[model samples]
Target: MDGMQGAAGTVRSGEVIKPAIAFESVHLDLGGREVLRDVSFSLPSGSFGCVIGPSGSGKTTVLRLAGGFLQAKNGSVCVGGVPRSGPSRDVAVVFQDYGRALLPWRDSYGNVSLALEAAGVPRSERKDRIERLLTTVGLGKHLHKYPSEMSGGMQQRLQIARCLAQEPRILLMDEPFGALDAMTRQTLQDELLRLVSDSGMTVLFVTHDLEEALYLGDVVVALAANPGRVDRVVTVPLPSPRSQLATREHSEFLRLRRELFGLMQDGHG
Candidate 1:
């Protein structure tokens, strides 16, 4: 193993630390097709966990289980130590299709206001709260801009702003930056790290890119396709507040990349 290898345990130093998200012996079948089998993992509060694998590996399925959009036939999907019954305000999801996710008829403010409104935020305080959420995702100046008026990156930011309005404890992201240009994706990745750090929101991000998984995740969970199952779990040892340049250049990063690449080559995906 190139990096620290382990699953997130339930206890830390004799103290029970409940994970923000936990999947235990999870199995699922869609249309008589086994999508996932005996899948399990945990994400500590405020930690970034990335799930990576080939197409049809059920990466998004795993995140959806956490979001309560899809249910597992066996085992449990728990959030904040409680079994997920259905969608809750405590979990917010950011989809990869930013264009479809945002409202074309709504401006940035209105788009973000939808969440607060759904959460029953008061009409009197909506403006300030919306402004703050927009500002956090770097959309402060584009408050009046519609989805068509903004670039892809801006549209994604607006979507993120809306999700943040729910004040979620856990964030589920499904390849959120996969469609953006290289520079835009990198920029958004950094912004996401900053936002999560400030909010202390646990994240379960699904991606196909191995390098992206390593750079952004505290734990990179690789899956094997055709009934997706956990293949490897690598706990990153790179220092926190990772640098796009220096971190990638570090020997450990390169080593982990090769290791994961080798895992993919071994028919795990």
Candidate 2:
């Protein structure tokens, strides 16, 4: 989030985790319209950060640049300290459309194995890893179930398992929980926290929900819509081991919520 971040992130005891994702004066355009301008931010290693904005704020565009699906028209976008021009195995994306993200014909096991297959993993070494990933995502019992057989949450979980199969160092999630019911969304949020903590992976998540961003992020980056540029970068000071009930009810959370709400509405830093 900031220089030598500790306590909340993986860097500790004078250790410094370099920014896994750095966008320096990044500029992008599509179809003759400037989408982003002079955008700059860095996500510290093992940190969970969110990008929030209204429509046309370039939130998804930022994620796409980070994931190497797009490149900056000016300046630089780097992942794992290297300039991103294309996709890498070190980076994996989990999209908002869990339904379309998964293969309809592939069972849970088959879907999870897709990543390994793309990487040319041998058939012998695939089963144990796939099984472990499915279990981690709470899909062990549904290993053979097709995408159509699972609920929205389960489908999302399977997609995550498939992504994790890549053994990625950074996870780029674009509102991966937006489609689920409230109860299921909260459940997946907690599960994601646990998963990230255990894996110690750096995350750059994009969401329009302020509460969701605050709940999951070590830092929140707010963008203004016109020409899509950074408005503010809010560091989360809420205590670690964040709980849905306690953290949401905390004064800090409320204060930050108000702060971001005004920013989003006012379209200013």
Candidate 3:
């Protein structure tokens, strides 16, 4: 309860602030099917927000909208107070499918270097930056390994390293750890928390696991499908840095889980 704190609603005294990401009554239609309906929420700077609900609840769509990969038909999605037009260097995404997200042809080092290349970092500077990024994600020794040779967790870590190479201010993660086993998933969850804390990056994570959402989020936003919309937004009051066992056993965590489970059940019914 005392290592680090979730910054969801905290503001320093006398500090006027704006949300890092804001969705204003947003509406979206994909292939004539409404995916999101009048959805709205705000993530404070440097806070971790988790989006959760029943399957097909537009959780990934919301992340995509925030990342500027998709546009809303009505209302607005803004980052740093500006309307999102398209993909920006300041934002990076970590997708659930690391196998697809990573380039199998490239080694770990080369994969991370791709970001630097896209950013136009000179050839001379790419080595140190790429090495640092891969090392930061615990891929230091596996730098020469291709995606096909790495384990699922390692590939996901490499994907994250590639994202970090962009030096993004905002990170959009769509179930990035869903494919891993429980232990690997928890390990990556903690790693992600540490990385975000160190970098002060605003994160919007989408996950179907209730415990995973509660464990990583500063605020949990529940959406209801059949035209996904915000059904509830609960601020996590638990202290950080959270532990896999202890935090999960915390009274508040259990309470929120029960509440979210009911909401999700209602959403599906």
* Models, CA RMSD each: 6.3, 5.8, 7.0
TM-score of each: 0.92, 0.92, 0.93
**lDDT of each residue in 82-167, candidate 2, tens digit only:** 89989999899999999998999999999999999999999999999999999999998999999999999999999999889999
Q: Show pairs that collide, candidate 3.
A: 4-240, 4-241
| Candidate 2: regions farther than 4 A off | 1-17, 267-269
In candidate 3, what are the lDDT values of residues 1-269, reduced to their tens digit?
A: 33234353254431457789999999999999989999999999999999999986899999999999998879999998889999999999999999999988999999999999999999999999888888899999998999999999999999999999999999999999999999999999999999999999999999999899999999989999888999989999989999998999999999999888987887667
Lowest lDDT sum, 10 consecutive residues, model 2, at 8-17
The residue pairs found clashing in candidate 2 are none
Q: lDDT value for candidate 1?
A: 0.90
Compared with the true structure, all predictions reach lDDT values of: 0.90, 0.92, 0.92
lDDT-wise, the better of 1 and 2 is: 2
How many backbone clashes are present in model 3?
2
**Candidate no. 1 TM-score:** 0.92
